[model samples]
Target: MYGGVAAVKELSLIVCRGEFLTILGPSGSGKTTALMLLAGFISPTNGDILVGGKSVASVPSYRRDQGIVFQSYALFPHLSVRRNLEFPLEMRGVKAAERADRVANLLARVHLDNFGDRMPSQLSGGQQQRVALARALIADPPVLLLDEPLGALDRNLREQMQSEIKTLHKEFGITTVCVTHDQEEALTLSDRIIVMRGGAIEQIDTPEGLYDRPKSLFVANFLGEANLLNGVIPLPNDATPTSMLSIIRPERIRLAVPHAPTLADAHQRQQANGVVTEVIYAGALRKYNVQVGNNVLIMREHVASDQQVFRPGDQVRLDWLRSDVRLVATETNNGVE
Candidate 1:
């Protein structure tokens, strides 16, 4: 709690060994506070943290055996890459000869073999990031903590670093806990994701599970693009309960020419017709906003050579298998209803 306000409330989780778990949410969602609590940087007012079957809640950040990578790439600006890598080993009383060997191998592993003599200021943003990651793993800690690790990089660079982090995680087999607001990053790198909302856990599931079958309306909209189907279209009698909300992903809805002939599986599909209100052309995919009744439903389709493109004001038919529609819980009184 910070100044009598609970940043995380009734939070309980278990991170499996060698698992890559990511805490994902928007600003003020307590994701970072949760990471800090795990890192021993902050104390939990009413709970204990156990690492490897022992209590570590009272352990200081420096005393806990863990690796941390900060968003700023907190490298020592005055030291050369080699010296920076050696600092941790030196503090741990490792011999000079062994430190040199370990530093040499790690520099090569991060693909900075020839640049070890350069200072932190001399390297590019990506290079600095690599150095930070290498330093964190140098001690070979059992746990790795990442706080918004990729937020400082550009789009292309962020994607590249994502692959690098994934590869290193596989090779090291270290249990990792990462915090980020980027849904794509969480989905791409996590074995499982925890969606946090208002200082509590909204949902915890595999990336595919969270995206395909969110447990709440907030999760459905947070993980990816969702089309809320409540009062917008007629649903089957048993499809959704009064306490649940119906939603479908944009990509799950198929677009066809207006008045198109019904398909063989028509009995299993729900169809609707609407005018195309907007058309978005992303390089590899086309997105359409169709006005059906009083709601604007979004649909996405891959751009193909033979695919017909729709324009604004064009009449279009949308259809999806009834099974594709998901029923999620609704929020009430600032909690799931």
Candidate 2:
């Protein structure tokens, strides 16, 4: 909470041992504040934080022993990579010989073995980030906290660092909590993710769970591209359509070429007739935007070696498996289903 405004409210979460949990949200959503609370940099307004069954809500930041990597890398510009890696050890009163050994081991671990003599300014962005991670881990902390750690790098470097970070997590087997606004990053890095909105937990589940079975409209729209149909969806063999919201992923939707038999085969699946409004090509996949009954839905499909491609102004039918339609609560203030 800040300035008497509730940043996070009625929040309770569990991070499993040795699990990588990511807190994903946009700016001003309180993900970073929650991270600070867990790191002991700030105390919760009225809650307890437990690590291994011990409550540490009031513990000081220095005593938490959780290694944190910030978005800025936060390396000592004047210090060589070796000294930067050694600072934490020195703070813990580790002897010179042990510090040297630990530094060497971490240098090798982060694949910066011969770069220790160089200053942070001399290394590339990715190299310096690796050093930051190495320094965080050199102290042998049980938990790792990362706050948008890849937000500073270029796209290519970000992807590379993501792979490196995942490798490190697998190798170290440490419980990790990362905060980021990037949906792709959360899906790629986290074993499970906590999606935050309005300073509160909107949803908490595995990446697949959140994507495939989102409980709310906000979640459905946030996790990926979703085509939402308002009002009741018409169920086959039912007389009346149920009043609610329905979601279908772009990829789950399939496009069928217009044929005379389509009307006769309508009973087999949920089908809608639409005119193609746009086509997008992106190497491996193609996206089609279709306009149907005052609604525009996007259908994404992989481009097979010998697949037929549809263009704008083409008449086509969009269909999906009955089970692919997910029902959601229509009212925004209503509790999630």
Candidate 3:
């Protein structure tokens, strides 16, 4: 127990060999604490932490042999880039010449070949992150722990580093555990994501499964833009429906010119009438806020230069395949997760 409060409960999942597992949750969700427990920085109150099928519950952080990269770069400000990378090898008693070779190879691998002589203060945020990653991998540990590794970087650099981290994981084939509050980052980088709330496992699935088939309202709303229409809605091929809140993705919604000719191929499925309330121009997609009765729904369409753009005050019809509608927990859902 953490301060007599359960910081994590019913948390169970295996980080497969060479798989990237991300623990995703909002603040105070115990994601960071879980990572620390896995890394031997903190011990679980009652539970076995197995590494390679052996319990390491009493092992200290330094003895775990797990590479860790903190949110802060954690590089020694007084050291040059090369020295920071060499420190791990030195601690392991590697000879100077061998450490030099490994450091050089890692520098080249992280695209920091020319910045080896510079200090951490001299490098850009992205560069420092790369150095931190290279250091984590320098010893070639079988398991890696990353605690909000990209939380410090800006948007553009965050994306760039994300690609780099994925490449590194693929090249090294290490079992990795990442803790992050960024949903997009988890979706983009994880092989399997574990969504945590109130220190418990809400759902654990691949990025696609979590987004397309979330069973809870909290997960449905947390992962992406979700429209929860109240009461019964169309279910699959059958017109007979069940009573529950209907969850539909914004992209699943299709908007068409009202009273226009219904195309024979598509857009003839389940339909509804609404007036455009707002149009948002997001670089690659146009998000339309539509009002149906007293409900306002969000519909996202791909932005095309040649397509007609619907504006506010325009009457539009929203259509979707019955298969796209997913029922939220009718009885099991009690408020949020």
**lDDT (C-alpha, whole model) for all candidates:** 0.93, 0.87, 0.87
Please give the TM-score that candidate 2 achieves against the real structure: 0.92
Candidate 3 segments exceeding 4 Å error: 231-243, 265-268, 330-337
State in Å the error of residue 253, model 2: 0.9
lDDT of 3 at 292: 88
As a TM-score, model 3 comes out at 0.94
Q: List the RMSD of every prediction in angstroms.
A: 1.5, 2.8, 2.3
- Top candidate, metric TM-score: 1
Per-residue lDDT, model 1, residue 176, is: 99
> Which pairs clash (backbone N, Cα, C closer than 3 Å) in model 2?
232-242
lDDT of 2: 0.87
lDDT of 3 by residue, 53-134 (tens): 9889899998888899999979999999999999999999999999999999999999999999999999999999999999
Which order, best to worst by TM-score? 1, 3, 2
TM for every model, in the order presented, reads 0.97, 0.92, 0.94
State the weakest 10-residue window (summed lDDT) of model 2: 231-240
Please give the lDDT score for candidate 1.
0.93
What C-alpha lDDT, on a 0 to 100 scale, does residue 176 get in candidate 3?
94
lDDT string, candidate 2, 1-337, tens digits: 6788877766799899999999998787789888988998888889899998999999999988889999999999999999999999999999999999999999999999999899998999899899989988999898999989999999999999999999999999999999999899999999999988777888899999999998777888888888975532454343223545678999998888877355544575687789999999998989999998789999999999887788899999888777788876443432333
- Cα lDDT tens digits, model 1, 151-265, are 9999999999999999999999999999999999999999999999889999899999999989888999999899988877665677655677889999999998988888999
Residue 283 in candidate 2 has what lDDT? 82
